[model samples]
Target: MNATAALHLIQAPVALCLDDEINIDLSATDPDGDELVYELTTPLHGANDIDPTAITPPPFTTIVWETGYSETYPIDSEPLFK
Candidate 1:
């Protein structure tokens, strides 16, 4: 059988303050009742080309964010996103 994991009852604040701390919940369930483990890692850069005729094929390459910008702090925000 294929591995299947699903998330339910996700919680998030409707509003976030600029001066706030990081909080997260990764609770999830598997129909097969397999134990779940969550870890944070940099995501892969699937495609970066603009208006390309074709998308790149695997093996996909890693990407880096510009200075002061990242997958988290992608845009300018009050007090910064970090």
Candidate 2:
């Protein structure tokens, strides 16, 4: 369920390990030739059933990671897509 994480799932170019940390490519393209800028942003998460107010505005909470996981790494490997 938590695919495309970190940089909306694209920020981290490589997977992270617990013992070793590495740099990831946070690069973005505009499709058209244009200047590029980078900035850090927070990830949001909530319940799927609670559809009410899911997109209703500002002051969103950041996502929390569990053990052996960050955002992009340690994803479920079942069913090919999970």
Candidate 3:
């Protein structure tokens, strides 16, 4: 038998206000109960040149998955500017 791993977003952000800080929880499950690591990915064709650690503003990075994965996400919205 082949073991597979998959990730599902339990709770996702639907809407947000300007300059809002919200705490979100992302949960994933595996049938085999295998260890999993979470990482924020972008739509890059096939390039690994951009080192996530050396970024200035700090792009979405990887995180070691635990029981509970919760983080406060900040949303910046400028209605007037747009």
Candidate 4:
């Protein structure tokens, strides 16, 4: 029982216009049906650092577990709200 689970991008953004909400979905399943957590990712930064403890590789971003889907989310911007 050494099955490894993997995520597959099912849907992706395409030809989006300005002020359009972005929607993406990644699906995965564990052979043992264990709990899973998803996170949003950011681009890797300076020195191409990939170290987990480098203090510069950037911490894990937002956890998307149990998040609301099938809804249009407004662009989170300070300028837009002001």
Question: If both were scored by TM-score, which would come out higher, candidate 1 or candidate 4?
Answer: 1
lDDT for model 3, on a 0 to 1 scale?
Answer: 0.51
Q: lDDT of all the models against the reference?
A: 0.69, 0.51, 0.51, 0.54
Residues 1-82, model 1: lDDT tens digits? 8578988776788888886664556677898889888654556676446754557689977677779766666667566645
The candidate that wins on lDDT is 1
lDDT of 3 by residue, 1-82 (tens): 6577765665657897777765566566777887777764333223345764443343555543344332322223344211
Q: Which ranges of candidate 1 are over 4 A from the true structure?
A: 1-3, 13-17, 47-55, 65-82
The parts of candidate 2 lying over 4 Å away from their true place are 1-31, 35-42, 72-82
Q: Best candidate per TM-score, number? A: 1
RMSD of 2: 12.1
Q: List runs of model 3 lying over 4 Å from the truth.
A: 3-9, 45-82
Give the 10-residue window scoring lowest on summed lDDT in candidate 4.
Answer: 65-74
lDDT of 2 by residue, 49-69 (tens): 758555635666777767766
- What does candidate 4's lDDT look like per residue over 1-82, in tens digits? 6678878756766587777665556679888888888654433433333665554445644433334421232235434421
TM-scores of all predicted structures: 0.47, 0.32, 0.38, 0.40
RMSD after CA superposition, every candidate: 6.0, 12.1, 12.3, 9.8
Worst 10 residues of 3 by lDDT: 73-82
lDDT of 4 at 69: 28
* Model 1 TM: 0.47
**Candidate 2: Cα lDDT at 3:** 30
